[model samples]
Target: MAGIGHITQDWEPVVIRKKAPNAAAKKDEKAVNAARRSGAEIETLKKSTAGTNKAASSSTSLNTRKLDEETENLSHDRVPTELKKAIMQARMDKKLTQSQLAQMINEKPQVIQEYESGKAIPNQQIITKLERTLGAKLRGKK
Candidate 1:
């Protein structure tokens, strides 16, 4: 009889051992937990601050209700009065006569007088020019 060779077979099923959790995996879990906690704390702080600020601001505004209009007036009062005063002041401060100011703005001296006297309303372009000349804010509208 001729010699024959037999193939070897794995009798036991190949087993894969479960891997132990790596250091990186543990670090990732810790970082995720810390981030969640920090987010929660930030939200809580914002809510608390918003509530107090809202209450404080509302109360302060309520207390100053009487002075609101007056403050607005001081800031820049009447449509006509403020514009007139601002123009005059700017002219005087610059030591420029009404005629000079008019020349600078390309208008007649009478036109400047009319504007200051509230006999006529200056257009936006003129007012802007006056504002620039006077270094003060002129009235836009009420």
Candidate 2:
């Protein structure tokens, strides 16, 4: 066998590289230049189109009184005058004020006032309450 000092050694080569340029920076510069050109065109157009007012006017006017009359005619479902008279007479016979009777029926005083004045829309629940409190037939078939 040969001695260890006579052995040969092998080595690998090393490489150097250069960096590539960024693609996004070139796209951003092109977009900024295009925006500047469009902005100048918009400013010139705005100056040329200034102070020309186009006011829109209508010829027809609404008749509110006619509408009111139509609505009043259509809404005919109200408390009858007879029912109002009965309610007022019964309340008077019992010596009860409108507020007192409203309390007895667990209702607001305005409800009693509306019923007496014939302005309230007929509600059977309220009518029954009034009948029970006043000991009278206030609804249906006399």
- The most accurate candidate by lDDT is 2
Show where candidate 2 strays beyond 4 Å. 1-73
In model 1, the worst 10-residue window by lDDT is 40-49
In angstroms, the error of model 2 at 14 is 30
Highest TM-score model number: 2
TM-score of each: 0.41, 0.49
Error of 1 at 17 (Å): 99
TM-score of 2: 0.49
Candidate 2 per-residue C-alpha lDDT over 1-142 given as tens digits, one digit per residue, 9 for 90 to 100: 7565777777877777756436564347675577577783322224543465322222222455556557444565789988999999899999999999999999999999999998999998999999999999877586
lDDT of 1 by residue, 5-42 (tens): 77677798888997865756545757557758778432
**Each prediction's Cα lDDT score?**
0.74, 0.81
